[model samples]
Target: MNFYKDLEPIRRPIKDVLAEQKLFTNFPDNWHVVVADIVNSTQAVKTGKHDDVNLIAAGSLIAAINAAKPFNTEIAYFFGGDGGTVIVPDEIVNKILSGLNAHKINSLKNFSLELRVGSITIGEIIKAGHELKVAKVEIGKGYNKSVVIGNGLKYAENIIKDNYLQDKESIEHQLLTIDSSELNLEGLECRWDRIKPLTSSLEVVCLLIEAVNFKNQSTVYRDVMIKLDEIYGEADKRHPITMNRLQLLTTFLKFKKEMMVRYSKWKIGHFLKAFFETLIGRLYFKYNWKVNDLKGQEYLEQVIAFSDTLTIDGRINTIVSGTKENRLRLLEYLNQQEQKGLLIFGHFVSTESIMTCYIENRNDKHIHFLDGSNGGYTEAAKELKPKLQML
Candidate 1:
């Protein structure tokens, strides 16, 4: 008898063959999966101009990828005409949400594009992919959108996995059952959590991945702070703070402080500068107020006049001293504004002295200082708009 002839024939599982399909080549184990579909692709193709639709689709995809990257997500596969999948890490959940929110807002505002995003954990992917034939059967019944099943079929496997059943269920429910309104609420909470002093020190770094992306550090920082304040104020109005809540609040503040310091070298200064300038511009127009040496005074005056507003007793105090003196003068002006019913202030700082200003109600004094170190008055004015809106 020939020993070779007696050997049993080699058998390979069908599941193994399917898993090796070209579409699932980049699938990673132990990952978080994100599937994003462009809403109304068929309509986009039928009624929309090809160029316009392409622009919208390209923008949407770019935004999604940018948002996902900060969360440590790797792009698994993207079907050009429909959707894509991303594998995310657990640590960057907050960043992912921030990116997604920013992307969604921009897309809606610009192109009326909508995206539906679903995320799951790695363990779920493996479990779902265990029996490739069964998973394929499910896909055949219109469940190809399932990332794990797609992976098993060698289509696209970008499923998220985790050990916590409750967490998984919460995420899944959020993805499937929650509407945009519910997402907005959750998003607001997530934003608050990022900037709260309690969590600010948690080292939640956002990776900037797009040239036109909207995740400005200063803007995010300011918005989160505002939201947290809103939440805390509401909670305070309802009940005396429990120790746990107070502790959480305190932690959030600390975390925010830490994040500010850590991300100081980023474009935050530019954002701050822009915020101040925009505010000044608006106030100038609103009250017909002007700094003696400011360049845009005429244009701003026109704006005020067009809006049917006139100055109601505003003062300008120019400081000749250095930057420190300028800050003191501005601070002093703020205090004086608190005393008077009307206050409007503006100044341009030379290299030797910082140019900035503040306006306030006599009874509701608020101080605003724009550092000359950041930019000149013109540049600072451009930066100030968003900050004013925040106020």
Candidate 2:
């Protein structure tokens, strides 16, 4: 019953975790990988709606999370800038898909963006000779993130995407046709304003890295983490979010945007209630009120503590803040690795960071997602994909 939940958290340095294959176990055959992405995200980002793109991607995880809650399994997921990937067992796949379809419909009606959702079983990927090595890594302050090594995710992405391309019209029809109104995004909050670095000298960089040879992935990624630890210091030294920079967005416009996600058809009464909640929230955070035994200051610490600043899903994707000098050194090291044909990387720079949060349980269970305000990982990918072509 504890398929996903009971895995012991690995507290070793992430570098060591990646190198120890025995630490990552194979996923069960009955499980499936669920993937979702906004179609035409490149053009969408150009229009300055990267925030919307980010939310839709987060939606997939939230919807699936809500669906899986009853089954009592902690599904592991990755939130890419434009979309996300989640893995769930077969017992709840239908309910999960239904919820995702509902979210897709909401996305089209509100943002005019097409969200494609699909799933492929682990059995099939294993049949095709790919591996799905997974583990839960404890980052700090009792929070954990799911890390994956091996080509399993890459193989699933390729197949799901190819299928979408071949059956484009079917996807469109399902979006309009699937009528599932049971999407409970209860604690999905995006109220924070864009977070600026603690100082003007620091800039946010969204970076992506992958090994060239499949077999070298373990060693290559291990080296990247070791290098990052050297350049960035511990995670706290270069964190983008700090207590002083945490401010709730109390604008009516912000409420209206969130309303579209919680309600399919808007209700003014509900909107007013939410607007008042934001007003009250502003004071709660400002005053550091101990409402319901949860401290605002302490919660801010956990927000930084639980933030998805670094993620490894057969590749390394991270957003961090640092001086230009530190960034240059990182690039220099990465370039040297690339020249050796050990790895390839892509990165984009921006002025500040933005956050979208999922806080189902205020005290114990929650995590925050961050992106560079401009484009984050998607913008970084523009550089990364071109490099892939020459290979």
Candidate 3:
């Protein structure tokens, strides 16, 4: 009369039970999990630097996995020379993908290494692990390259769920479109009129908004205001040939001044304002703070052109000749853009003479940058992805 007697018999063999016990013990239930491995391990070993390569490979894997953990996924097990296993809760699958993508980008940027990620739901692993052996096969397949195994998941799902998901191609396309649209607006405006089209000035305004949003210190705001005033004073000294153009520049400066004053009263304004000031300060130091120099003036022009092509929250790594004159020019260009409303963050590392800059609209999410001799722009960006969501 027992209900158990009416149920169908279990089909899994004894060995399967034992294996499942070994792998699935302590594994969380109702979660989606991913396991990743570095490809070409043997090749890295054959190069006679096996120990170093292994350490790096292991470090990269750990970093990538940890990066994903914040989204509610946990590393269940690590099988060195094989791969790692992750368990993700059903409710947080979208979060897990975002963390994974950010980790992938960071790993690529930091180590110049690529990853192949494979993910499977816990339910599938529990059900199919006994019959189809999907978990074992997929985990084994990911050894040298990155691949994901979940059937129902789509790229769009990842994008919608993860705010930090940065698609380089997509970002580039958007930037181009923003610039084109802005340029078209300029064409419709009277060329003889003094005021420039608003489109060209959006970045500057965005920066002001961001500065107001992220800055936290009153002193920082005060300092930024001083710097802004100095920039305006210099512009006044130049005295453009056309009164309309001069008026336009003055009006823009006045707008920023008012925005800065309002920004200082907000809770986060100090931090954002400070960051902007620091960015401008760094650029100034790189250029020796020579605002009136002609070369400095030209550098500012190039920065504007470059700014038009940048994605909000994008980073750029470039090496320019490191000279007092060159740095001064860079500062001038950056300050001009700042006045125009572009939020720019940049620094120059002396050891490598690398000028790394992160530029974005003020309201756009914050993207981090790493400044140093080696190339780690991707890694910095990857790490920043999660932080960007906090915005």
TM-score of each: 0.28, 0.96, 0.26
Query: Tens digits of per-residue lDDT for model 1 on 360-391?
Result: 22112211111221122223233333433343
Model 3 lDDT per residue over 101-173, tens place? 4444443444444444555654554454321111221111111111122222222123232422345456334
> Which 10 consecutive positions of candidate 3 have the poorest summed lDDT?
182-191
TM-score winner between 2 and 3, please give it.
2
Superposition-based RMSD of candidate 1 using all C-alpha atoms, in angstroms:
27.5
Which one is best on TM-score? 2
Global local distance difference test of model 1 = 0.31
Model 3: per-residue Cα lDDT at residue 110: 41
Model 1, residue 137: C-alpha shift (Å): 29
lDDT of 3 at 359: 28
| Error in Å for residue 121 of model 3 | 0.8
Q: Model 2: per-residue lDDT, tens digit, 1-391?
A: 3677888999987888987888988788989999988888878989989888887788778888898898878888988888889888888888888888888888888889888888999999999998887899888856878998888888898899999999989878766667756767767778888999999999999999988876668889988988888998777887877889888877776777777875656769867876787788778778888877888787778888888898888899999889999999999999999999998899999998988888887786787888887888889989998888787
lDDT of each: 0.31, 0.85, 0.31
